[model samples]
Target chain A: MSTQTVGTAYRPSLGKRVQGWLAGRFAMIVAVLVLLYLFLPVFYTFIFSFNDYRKSNIEWRGFTLKHWANPCGAAGACDSLVTSLEIGLLSTLVATMLGTLVAFALVRHRFRGRGASNILVFVPMATPEIVLGASLLTIFVNGFTQLNGWFGTDLKLGFWTITIAHIMFCISFVVVSVKARLQSLDPRLEEAAQDLYAGPAETFWKITFPLVLPGIVGAALLAFSLSFDDFIITSFVSGNETTFPKFVYVSYLRGIPAQANVIGFSMFVIALALVIIGQIVGNARKK
Target chain B: MSALAHMGGGGAPATAMPPKEPSGRSWLPYLLLLPGVLWLLVFFIYPLAQLFAVSLYSDYPDYPGYYYQDVNWHNYVRALTDFLPHFGRSMLYAGLATFFAFVLAYPLAYAMAFKAGKWRGIMMILVIAPFFTSFILRTIAWRQILADEGPVAWVLEHLHLLSFMPNGRITETWVAVVAGLTYNFLPFMVLPIYASLERADPRVIEAGGDLYANGFTTFRTVTLPMSMPGVIAGTLLTFIPAAGDYVNAELLGSDTGTKMVGNVIESQFFKVLGGYPIAAALSFSLMALILAMVFLYVRRYGTEELL
Candidate 1:
């Protein structure tokens, strides 16, 4: 140790010192630049929300807050927003429920077909979104016609179809998130509960469920965000129904409205707020 | 639940799994797994089968939206012959995007993992913040930023770099499409690398330094290898989505020149008369190509940590 200390005690030359300094700060500099690149579009969206343009919101004309105040002024923007929220909420609920159960099973039980279950969760994630969308569209386009033929029922591709697709993809992510949490939990905690004479249902409800609630909440948030922000799959399955992203895209050819920007940026802010609050609560609970 | 309790206290070796429960409630695992598994089986697995069947159906003569059941091998032949350029462009663009995203993400992820310290949590949130906004909106913003009248073009024109761009334009070019792919998928590359790096043992790295190794040598030998699993996972995630994306090309690239396979599939499915079989065939081809590439990649550089 003394020899090593003495060896490094020799002062570095100017070039070596300069090289060392550059090496140390290099990651920090690159990180800041990358962060700027990541936020470029977000900054544009926020700035455009206040644009006072006559026709298109593409070019910056003058700055005003009217669009933010009247975000629903444009025709179908709010309707599409409502549709997205409904789909996001409904899909999040169903995916979370189904995914949590699967997570518990995979983490706790040694069952037949366990290997197959893991692969089933993995394949959807590995397949490209375009493929998923195309396949679902094919199934619905053909299946709906058959149903309409046989049962005198009019089955169509719209809200339900979009929601079903959302749930399909969201389940994999929910499983991953919840499974990570379940795996990290100490089995000893459950053993302690059993030693205290708690019933099986009582142990689950009073101990395990409370401990895992945060993970479930996080998974639900992720599922909702994914469902809301999706475009490619929804564009295919949402036959006549328009979601927020679809509305933004369809309007782009004719120039997007500033109100669309307003709603989009507002969602960003709301989501950020929710995440920050969650982090603070989590930290407080930990301490 | 009793099964869980007994397994922990059975005094069996830790490596051994618990014996199967004899209770009537042994069906719980299947019950718990049934709903989500059935959903995936119905929507994901069944839809792919339906798409394969659709890909084989031939179009009815002189009918725009009508098809007849037939074993049509011609659809695959036509897909490969007609859209070969699109398939090539998709691979090239997605490959370039994945490479560039890795170059751009690595340093940021490294800093967040080792440096940043107290600022790590905030940086993590910032990394995910862009996802809260609509991706289409973000891609359109890139279009505006790269437009002829935008700041980028104006600055480039003043700096004599405008001559490098074809027709003195950036917006409707391959560069714009590739840039959009890299930007949209950058976070997917970052988070995984950051995660693996964060989980790496710092003591192992410190040992390299203590052995009188130079910093670069230490990093190459120890740190980079530690993060390989994340790199593989990140590349796969970025590559798959970027290859399948069409919005960037549609919004930012030229309609005639820069279209990828995704654009061809989208248009064929929606626009062309009697285009269903060809589109389905094209989609199947893309999936097969991606799966093959992934298999080759994992065979070469896979880690057991990957799902």
Candidate 2:
């Protein structure tokens, strides 16, 4: 792998060596700058969680631990966070299950509309959130009204509606992630299991399920994140309900409380910890 | 069960069993697919059709909502005429942000893919870590950073760069919105490009150099072409979301001039009463336009695998 001339024992000139060295350093410098740019806002959000501002969280007020000490001090912020968590968990469960099933069906056993189903799965992922939200709103509003007219029962838009929207969107992402994993699987392992007199069910449970478990877990994680971080679609369908993002949007018009920053930074730290742990475990397994 | 029995016969190895045919009688795949497809049918496909129908409805002047008339086309015309500026702004901002994201992401992705060596995992964690924070909070941080009295404006003012800026500020300007878009979506651009570049054979790149091509020349000929699929995916991911994003504009841009089509649709649906038909029309039009553009772009630059 060495670029040095083997026979001639030739060495590059000082200027050439320096140029080569700089060229390598240049990529590193650009990468550092880009990474810095990406983290600037995150850094700001983390640091400002300690700000002791009375009114606005925008300025560099004197530092204090009051925000973190009472993270739920802001009236509706923690409630909204809880709501988001609930929606995220419920949607992740539903989406992961349904999406994994569809993914298995697509990758393992093909049906008549498999190609069309693939396209159908992708449509939700590709369509803009605004369009998705607006379209879903039309359905809910019209459908709910018709139901009310027919049954004299009120079906309101709230947690259930937002959860549904989240699941609808999260399904596509889960399907894609799980499908990739399923496609990459070695089919021979299943055959080998079957050759050992294992029933199809036993083979699947012993071989295929364990292998695809990581994919399913990864997909579930992705679905949870997508559901948690959703804003626009949740906004459209979440009538008279506030999720974390909705709380931030409404609070932004005024100065957001530092407690919100506390929540944001805490979430970031938790997610970072989870990722690092996942990576360590992944690397450990590889070893 | 029969297939399992056949495989267990021990006369022939189970490994030699041909892949299952698609026409097999097992209904398991269909059963598995049922819930997911049904969910999509009810929420995604059905809503899309309802949206189209709503788009054709006419607004009842005295009422809070619209009534469905048969296939009224004037809603599309009115949306086009009235909100043309917002549509144009959305495309312009999204395009500019995509370009900026590409410029920033390419080198970072390249370094991670080719030069980071053992630091790749840590570097990837850094790239994705910001996304764990709430997107709204990140943009809100940008609002603070780009505020007129904030550090960015102060530095620009002192450095004499504010002369070109409208009203000598970054907040409430298209610059802030675009910057937010670029920053927020940079990870989307980086990850895919990095994936493609990381998969590229190092020997192929070395072969380019072995042919007496300079670094830049080798990159232009070999690396860039191999990474086109990633580039295409990244651009589409960034542009589509950026175009549809109203968060940046709402948070950073002034209410008067910086409205994007997303903002228009949002306000139409949530803020203005009896604006449902117009909003639906706008949504339909935007979807159609984006789909058409994506189709054309994909046809031009995409590989079959990408499709």
Candidate 3:
């Protein structure tokens, strides 16, 4: 209770202050433990990836890169990785473009059923993935069969359907993220450009577009990551196309794959760095 | 709805128009919104409707065509009975996990918002950073830590601390699923609770202390009342997703009895001989159930602040 002390003067005794400081920091310890809990699986898989034998069962049969080098050693590991990337990239493009357009429309214009339109993304979010998955599969099955089913539809499961489904879900994330930003932006900027004799298209490209450009880019990355990361929805519509997570889920039954860790670590590191950089750059730009 | 309703109220028209339709330039918004609208319609609404259609027209297993004919709501009836246990399990698990998440998130959120002056940003960042990777990847990581041979079980078993967890096997169990849900949803809880806890000043507690109240009494009197909104938000965030999640079950839970309604629906669609109509019906029911739960939640606890 001394006035001479800086922050601790009014508090209890010195021991109590020390205890209070430790108590205040107790949350940090829990936060750290949580971080560890969340990432523990990734660390586990990453470490296990180095094990020599395929069925090392994570007992760790000494360190080795046999899994990464021998993708076939991990059973369809290589093919699935490539397939995931292809679908992820295609889905990302569709989602980003469509989402951005939707964001622009809502932010800039007032069409019929605008309220209904805003609720559209919420529908997808609210609907269970199983429902979404089955229905999409049904539509695709019926539509594809009608188009080529006399030829048997060739829909044993592959990339196109998978990509479409991924795009569908990924677009929602993009739309939501971009829409929030577009709402915050001064819509007046576009009007100013228009008043300056700039055409609507030109004004959009020059002024309105640049404002939320970061959000669009960020949303694109988010879409890509989401599309890349999906499992349940992707698994349903995927007749044959195997994305990374899907591959992991399937192989999980046949016994864990060592390459899973390698893939997981690579993806984890890249995604983390992208997010960190985006946040850093975003903060800097704001400043 | 509030979001879309508020648009275009204050914005000046951005496009210069030609003669007669000068005011009609507002249609530009429609043009902009068109693509997003169509995308949602085709991807979201239409598919959902299609799902409903399938639920109403379930084909028996081994039926030839992709989906069979004639409307039949019997699938919903069957799903109700057959999957009732799984649904119950989901609710229980989700409810328990949410309860625990709130408990753990409270202290951490309190620290971040009220105590950790400088470390707040770094701690929040750390909390959310794992989200950068796909959730599936992160959840998959749990597989390793909980494996029969992993450290968790090994440590417990080796330390003779397996009283509650005999032999300390972690994977392929409800505990794993709950752990996964709790771990993944921690931040959702923490952020909201943090926001709520931040609203209360230290002075409030000090006031209670001045009145001769102990720490517990002060916290109960002053801290808990104002943080209810955050508590609500955090609980909702953790509970909803945990209930709907299939990944945690697929990764951590045992096959029998552990399969949630999510897994059941997934089985209908992809793995087990899919019944699109039946699956659709199941999905619709799930949607209805969730909405009902939310509705009840709103009634019991005000909805305006939970979000």
Candidate 4:
């Protein structure tokens, strides 16, 4: 379109022409710069993954692959990473199941108190993590003890508390994502299945479930990421247990070991590879 | 088999006029909803109620970590009186970050929506790929990238841009905190805006060009208005998390001056012995404040629909 204007009979001033040229490319230029800005820290993390720093991973010491070879060489890095994965997996599984059911109920069937249910799902997402964490801590500390009135019966703030908190938050995200996918679906497809003599159970299993599987998978992935990346709420409820983020944060006072960087970068690469593979599989199915 | 045949006959008529509310086994929805609602009521709703109760509890004078049930409202008073500045800083920093994120994200989202064409999927992957890394690691990376002796500071110093800075450094300042907030939540802003813009009809935008109005005018009047829902959703998403965040401030900013409400809540809960009541009070206050602001903001500028 811009090319069509070139070499036209009427010509604007040089300043106007320059302004027009810039205006044409403005969005792309800003997009490229913003993309660079977004990746700046990521690049830094990747580059420093090879740093051979005895004390700190901050400075670019001469490069070495030893950290990459033994990513768990840092004192508690691997332990914390394993703990985070356990919590993340447990929370994601529970949250995805609960959330997907709720999403189906809301989208597929009408019920009393539907609006109230929506608000319940939304309020958790709107509330800050600090508030959620603090509230949960208070409950664990005194609320449960008051209920049971039994010494040593109160829930301890540790692995269970952290997993519970992660599930509590992750449910909202899963519900929202799955609800969106369910809403966008064409009801006619299900109707078509019914018209072909499939019963409710068969139609659901064969038709609706397959269509909604992508949304469920996406929601599960979202839940896992939210649980895994969470630090604030986990920090509050994790009394003695340390997660990966918490370890990195506490270790920051003393310079972080390069192993932390190595692990972080590896996770990034792994997730990216998984997403690309999923896309390829999806494209192949389409073809 | 007979019941199935009858149901199949009923389904054909229903398709011509799609039912607004699909009638099925009445018990099924309730069954599906029961477990999730129970979990939420126990964990989320009940915990909030307990927090409110704890906020009103009086401290047991001799015991530092223990408190008794009492209707002592003074915790709110103490939280407000002591940590007003932290709240103020949180709002200010979060607002600035939201504004900067909007500015930076709008163009990128716009480009991805209209200009990327074949590269749109890859662009999306690129935007979201950063989330795969630990946010703390990324923020700390910013500390290294923008170190006082780093190239950014060096270039700024040579360009005379360092005059505006209080101590001629970027690492240990509010600027760094705001930058980190903006950086961390940039994807939240971008995704919603891109989704809305991508849904928009390209012909509508071309119609603006078809008319006498120029590019900027068309955008101001047409494109921006169409994407207002996205803008509202994006701003709320970015601002809410950024406002409550402490990690960026703790990692990037100085110790005292840049502390936010989250930091105060964290320390009050974790560090201070008899700080539970006050921390709970502060948490309630922050939630109420954010909810009220969100209510008013939505009432004023909200679209008919949002995620």
RMSD in Å for candidate 1, one decimal? 5.2
Residues A1-287, model 1: lDDT tens digits: 99877766787544455545645898889999999999999999999899899988877789898987888999999999999999999999999999999888877788888888987887787788999999999889889989899998999999999999999999987887777666657778989999999999999999899988877887888789889999999999999999999999999989999988889999999988988887898799899
Better of 2 and 3 by lDDT: 2
In candidate 2, stretches whose alpha carbon ends up further than 4 angstroms from where it belongs are A1-23, B1-24, B61-64
Which residue pairs overlap in candidate 2's backbone?
A: none
What would the per-residue lDDT of candidate 4 be over residues B1-307, giving only the tens digit for each residue? Answer: 0011111011111223223455556777789999898999989999999999989989878887878898998999999989999999999999999999999999998898888988887788888889889999999999987789877788999999986886878988999999999999888888878877877787897686546345666678888887776787788878998989999999999997999999999988888899888999999999999988887887798542332
Top candidate, metric lDDT: 1
Q: What pairs collide in candidate 4?
A: none
Candidate with the larger DockQ of 3 and 4: 4
Task: Flag the better candidate by DockQ, 1 or 2.
Answer: 1
lDDT of 2 at A97: 98
Candidate 4 iRMSD, 1 decimal: 8.9
For candidate 1 chain A, the 10 contiguous residues with the lowest summed lDDT are A13-22
**lDDT (0 to 1) per candidate:** 0.86, 0.84, 0.69, 0.83
Q: Lowest lDDT 10-mer window, candidate 2 chain B?
A: B1-10
At residue A277, what lDDT does model 1 achieve?
Answer: 89
**Best first by lDDT, ranked:** 1, 2, 4, 3
Residue A230 of model 4, lDDT score = 90
Candidate 2 lDDT over residue span A59-107, tens digit each: 7769899989999999999999999999999999999999999988877
Two-chain DockQ for model 1: 0.48
User: How much is the TM-score of the A chain of model 1?
Assistant: 0.92
